[model samples]
Target: MSTWTEIGDRCWVRRYDEWDLNVGLVAGSDGAVVIDTRATAEQGSELLTHIRELTDVPVRWVVNTHAHFDHVVGNSVFTDATIYLHENAAAEEDLAGTTFSVAKVIDLGDRRVELLHLGNAHTSGDTVVVVPDADVFFVGDLVEESAPPSYGEDSFPLEWPDTIDRVIGMLSDTAKVVPGHGAVVDAEFVRDQAGDIGTVANTISGLHHAGTSLADALQHTEDWPWPLEQLQDAIKRGYGALGAPRRPTLPLLGPGSSA
Candidate 1:
């Protein structure tokens, strides 16, 4: 059980060793909001206990930054609170919660928490939770510090930079940025990450336009911002986004021509 670190006025982040996950909490006069529940109901229950350490305010809301299991599976623990998830994440399963398409403003009586879906970056359904008064942004998987942003089959490598750009637009100089799984960062850190993501996007575009085969793409570029192994999915998805030509299907060998 990791201890909670205060990043803003009443905003706190708890970092866990497993998956290096970070769970957030914001307290208001009347209620509190828990951001990104851990990986399971038991973890969520434990998170609630940690929240009690800071304030006994009732947790009235549960915001799932995306549909990732690490960020949302603990939703069941907050049985009384209204769980919120992006429509896309909700579509992945029969999630019992409120679904918002673009954005949703949650009022915790004394403070307002804004949930914004900037664009497709980490995932199509990635959500950024903003504690306006506290100048804190809980960007789930959009900005990572523990590791390079995870690029899976559902990731949007090309669109990620633009999505991060939108997040950058919302930050102030002293704003504390809590990643889904890392130490709290600032706007400058996010900008650097956005730059890296942009570089990868451009590299992928350049390779695709140059008629480079996906199989040989990695061999051509040696200076990737992230590890080559981690960027494999990025390259594959980037080429896919650009509609790069697929390998032609070879016809079966004729019996007469075969030895």
Candidate 2:
């Protein structure tokens, strides 16, 4: 069974595993908001069962934090709620032919869910669901617990900090931040992670602009505050793919470091 943690009368967090993923449920006087649908149909159904036990209030809104399969594939289960996402997310869904489709949103209670496209951050399609009454923001992938931000080909690592700053500015002092993969955290934790990610991105940018070959940059991995073992592997793979020279003498760091 998925582990569920209750944060408030109206807020509960669900963890599938230590590194699996997480989803949030925000109860409302009239209805509720289901943060992310889970990675598979079965998982989504399990989550729905838990929500039903809490309140019979219809799930009026379903928010897709990002288009990652782990975060959005199960949206099919919420066939009755309006699905909302960032415009870029919708576009991604369209391109990939994921189970979710624009037509499905209309069929789901005829609710044309609002898709607000906040510019690039974790992914080009990142969107935060604001529970106005509950004063909670459900952010996906944008904030991690202790893990360094994962930079993907689609991610804007350099712009991530600014996006997080905007999110903090939009929240009240008491606003809660529910991230995509970890335990619920406060705005302060979010800021700290953003700062770390910014640092790594800046370091990479500087090295890249300095004509530091990928091999030379890997040699300078010590410059990063985090460990570089995992990143070293990634770097090696990247260089191999590009047919670039490999570097030696790279020190490895433990998991959760910017490495």
Model number with the top lDDT: 1
| Cα-based lDDT at residue 237, candidate 1 | 89
Cα lDDT computed for each candidate against the true fold: 0.88, 0.68
lDDT tens digits, residues 90-179, model 2?
Answer: 787662322232212212232222224455777878877665545676678888774656666567755666788778787766777778
The segments of candidate 2 whose C-alpha lies over 4 angstroms from its true place after superposition are 1-9, 95-116, 229-259
Off by over 4 Å in 1: 246-259
Candidate 2 structure lDDT: 0.68
Query: Model 2 TM-score?
Result: 0.75
Indicate the worst ten consecutive residues by lDDT in candidate 1: 241-250
Clashes of each: 0, 0
Residue-by-residue lDDT tens digits, candidate 1, 160-251 = 99999989998999999999888889999999988988988888888888778988986665658888888888998887788865555778
lDDT at residue 203 of model 2 (Cα atoms) = 70
Give every collision pair in model 2: none
